[model samples]
Target: MPNPLAAVAAVMIAVSVAARALIAHRGYLAYDDFPILSMADRNDPTPDYLFRLFNNHFMPGGHLLSWLALRFGGFGYGPFLALLVAGQAAVSVAFYRLLRLMLPATWTLLVPLTVFLFTPLTLEAGTWWAVGVNVLPMQLAMVLAVGAQVKYVRTRRPLHLVTLGLSILLGLLFFEKAILAVALVFLVTACLYGDGLWSTIRRWWPSWLVLTGVSLAFLGLYSALATSSVRRPSSVAEVLTFIGQAISHTLLPGLIGGPWAWFPAGDGAPIASPPPAARWTAIVITAAFVAYTIWRRRTTASRAWLLLVFYLALVLGLLGATRMGSVYSAVAGSVPRYIADVAVVAALAIGVALCGIQEREEKAAKIRMSPILLTGLAALLLSSAFTGIRYGDEWAKKAGRDYLANARADLATLPAGTVFMDQPVPEGVVGPLSAPYNRQSEFFAPLPEGPVFVTQGRDIRVFDQAGHVVKGWIDGPANRPGPRQGCGYRITGGPVRIPLTASTAEYWHVIRIAYLSDRDASATVRLGDGEPRGFDVHRGLNAMFVVVYGGGAEVVLESGDPAAGICTDEVAVGDLVPAPAN
Candidate 1:
């Protein structure tokens, strides 16, 4: 029969996948997801193109995985999610194998493995394709590298050493932060089977040297070619602050709780720091935990210490590389995706700690203790899993809604050959045009063929080939009324007709204009070829409305009295919508 542990591992993987199923049908978020989708839809993703793409960034392995998924899966959310779930499953299996190598064959190991598999911290990484593409592969590589180190220690096989080196290299390519894999292996070896610090270094120097060389080469390539726009830390104070926040975030949630509020589903606001009281409490608890571990250093096995050290190293390594910039807030470093690896490390540490204590107790006397601690841990794990699933569902709903709204807006407003520019919208609003790194050619790459050019920066403005402002266009005004108080242009000539494009015709079936007249007058408004509709214009701000269908229209604002024609301020349009009240 197959190993019983395999069955447990399968269950954990299934549960993890099931928790994130809410996002299976969701569309891409307004980020690198669209660019990856664009590249994947290419008819010829040639080696040259792929090389250029990877060389432009630090994550070649991650981009390679995304390319394969998009090329084969055809940009469907389900297929991309399946790839991510598969990566998560692979990581789970690797962790199980690594645990089996360290811990005795007992059901107790399941506790830590379950926690590792089900933590809420995994939701963003598992559900978001852009994040998962980097995180999942790096995690799998890290775990496999650690397992290879364990095997090499036992069998002293050259193949295992080669496997370890290759795994580390692969992990580094996937994410620059994967350099922690070597550090983790060294810590585990020292904790579990070190004779002396010098002796350990002497024995492992060859493997260390190989991995170090690989890491240095990878760093050099990344530094030379990296096009990251993120700002790096300028001072030692910023570095310490970033690292401290990362460590506190990693520990507090798994041990004491409260980071759940940081999830996107909760409050929809980013948290800068934990409460002062909670921070103090965490500091005290951490100090006490460290003191206890030191007091029992000789009696306790190094497995627990290994787990603790690895946990710290993982947090510091990942966060230090990514969150070193002063632009990053404390809460930014605490995001669930960034801390998932830390959560897994914490869970393993807890398991190893329990195992160490139990072993020491059994050596003194044979006794069975109450399962209260185990029961509490189980409860925490279940609660966290449920919370994670709920949060995933909420986040998926928001992302899907926002994406659909943005696509609809794009389709309605942007005409073929239109050069689109983005202006920042308020948070929570639909804004695909305002997404980061949006290129002029890839605006609608995932959709049907279109002549749309989208560029980043500034608001929409129309200009002719001669660089002169194109007049009478809704977005580009030819003339400005001098000394006006309100918004929009003040009409001085005969009846001014503002032309609308095809996109505007489709987007807005109704047009509403806010205006003001110096004298009592009636202004006529015509949409498309429809008959003119007249509205009484008051001296103060007034409103005029019209409805249109199919092709573009012209808004004719002709004043009954030409002495004070019209001073129009704001013109808004929407599809068959009621006009806003003055």
Candidate 2:
């Protein structure tokens, strides 16, 4: 009465969905994903809002998801990522259905689970909302497109024709970075029956036309709003390199086991780049599989096998061809993902191979019937979850929580609309993520505009009105860390004045100073001709010298007992404090 296989698939998929959704839901959005907010603020009031939106190089699905988030998120990030992860999980199930149709009863549940479990990176695509939105819809389109084609051939129904058309349309939405498998599907169909135009047209014509229509529509859409720069393939040798990378990235330690030695450091570090050996290995394996299948081609089942192989090969060859290397270069890195869909078809061949065997000893029979298969399934899920968690950790590091807590107190002090410039002030945030403040905003919407100074990364004049230097800093005083005595620092070309409209006690922007002192260096603060004051560097990033007496001075980071991570660099004085409490 109860199907063990169906139950496993249901449970595993549900668990996978919940795990990935949590990761996507937890963090603040950054970089490319955050750009959607800037675009939303575009003030572009025209029908072309959607049209112009897709023009950016990032694929489409992400854009659509973020826009939807803006409508309801009030521009927040959590719900947006949550929605994307959920969508991706649903689409993943769609691919699961496609697997069900292709695999036999025994392999049906195991194969799909094995594939996801083995591929760790899939979690990143599934969990990171930006990546999830792009990957899931495209994978769903691929599954549907293939499914529709399969149904059309079996049923010869016009409804299938319409379905295929829509699937193709969905597939065309973005370069999708995954649809390169279409060509493989085509070639697999070709190799099944010796190819010819009329025969080809009859058997695969609908798919061909549908795919073409999809291509044209997507290209038109890309042309309309795209300013994406094309990446050049560095060299022909890169072909071999990319394939190798794909192989390593795709099946390592799962399909074929390997020691943990090869794994990268910390989950956040970049993955292994494409390697050359893996590429050729893939080719050899594919050729061997096809050759064996064709040699054994006999029953109607064998003919179907040939179709899948030929279709997959044609797609690979088309994608793999290097003449216009640039066009296919990024694909080399993407090959692992491409192989995932192909592996589903390949799993069918493997199942057939196992089923075809005649006789075996009891022990041997168990290997075939259970342990090898069961162990493989368990291993796959564990690997996938591990990989997913690694990616989650990586996303968090890139998102920057530790640094934000330290910076936020200072940033919060400055009212919105205040501009405090310093080295590495991340494009929109007060400090640069690479340099200091996490760069999070899309278009830098300056809250308070004034002179910006300090230069560990970039110059300040870019955001200032007068093109003169204004240095600003935010840090706690001395070793003590908290709200009080928070040393706010800044330096500008001229004297700072409290606007009649602004409170005299509440300075819109203050000053940041670093001095060359050990015990305590007291300095002077003079607004126009106010008075000289002194302050000490709290820990670091706050070391700058301000010259209040000499035209309005500079702050030099005083070196004494070496701080944990301070490089010997000069600090500017008169750095504006958001609110100079003193």
Query: How far off is residue 90 in model 1, in Å?
Result: 0.9
Per-residue lDDT value at 92 in model 2: 59
Error of 1 at 66 (Å): 2.4
Per-residue lDDT tens digits for candidate 2, residues 1-582, read: 998877777776777677767665545555444444556554343445544443244355455555567666644566766676566666657656655654345543455455543354454455544445555666666677666765666677888878877775565453344445465445434533325557866776767777677667666766667664444456667756665445455534323321111333221222432245643454565456445544543332365566555645544454455322664465454433344444434443444333321111122222134575567566556655655565555555542233334344445454444433433333432223222122323233221322233322211222222222233344322211212233322222232222111112212223333322323322334333334434433443434333233222222222233332222222223333333334
Looking at candidate 2, what is the lDDT of residue 236? 66
Off by over 4 Å in 1: 1-5, 23-30, 39-44, 51-57, 73-75, 227-244, 255-258, 263-303, 310-325, 356-370, 399-401, 404-436, 439-441, 449-582
Model 1: colliding residue pairs: 417-451
Could you tell me the lDDT of residue 242 within candidate 2? 62
> Could you give candidate 1's per-residue lDDT for residues 277-358 as a string of tens digits?
6566666765665464445443343466565766676666555655666444545556666666665566656555544443
Highest TM-score scorer: 1
lDDT for model 2, please: 0.45
**Each model's lDDT:** 0.57, 0.45
